[model samples]
Target: MIVNLGDQLFMQLQLRGTIWTQTITNLRTNWAVNFSIDLLGQSQNYLYFRIEQYGSTFVDDAVYLNSKWKFARPSNQGCTLAFRGIKDFVSTPQLSADGLSCSVVKIIQRAKENPRPGF
Candidate 1:
């Protein structure tokens, strides 16, 4: 499948009063198949992501807390996930007006440049 120039995707999980968010942007679908991910929640300092591609499943895990975060993978299937973190005081907030929680934020998935062929 060809993802075109600027496509987006995401996986979200609501767990125990907390929501885990992940997003992919600027996606290129060349050499890819069956791409999806699920947030298995966090443990200690590690955020676990379960990724499924081409019938194979694995984890893209990272150790991060109270900081900006991003994750990307390129293979027969490719993915890019990002978090804007906290905006500076002088800068306008993207997700919320009051501010954002380091633990929980919003996740969005959309086709920025082009949508899939068949509506």
Candidate 2:
């Protein structure tokens, strides 16, 4: 789906298998921007970057953008999928294992509490 951020800026979101990605276009002329979030990761780890062009090469400053939109909240139990704006997640782990761990427990519990109708 495509979302309008304002003016001429728009974002494109996509989900495939285990990975979800969002690409922001018409924001800056010198950089290409996007982010990828893994719904099924221990760290609930995500990546956001604005690839800045330097002559002929692109560089990863590792900056990110956030949105009000969220996913898998039932599993988050109470964690979050909200605003985690710009940061070098490599040097700074984005989320806590404890926070993400709750999601796992919630998933298992939900499965037990609400079993599927059939195979």
TM, every model: 0.20, 0.27
How much lDDT does each candidate structure score? 0.28, 0.36
- Give one clash count per candidate, in the order shown: 0, 0
The list of candidate 1 runs beyond 4 A from truth reads: 16-44, 48-100, 103-119
Q: Give one digit per residue, the lDDT tens place, for model 1 in 53-96.
A: 45533232211212223222212211122332232111121222
Residues 61-102 of candidate 2 have per-residue lDDT tens digits of 222333222344333333433333232131212333444322
TM-score of candidate 1 on Cα atoms, chains taken together: 0.20
For candidate 1, the lDDT comes to 0.28
Q: Give lDDT: candidate 2, residue 116.
A: 17
Candidate 1 local lDDT, residue 112: 30
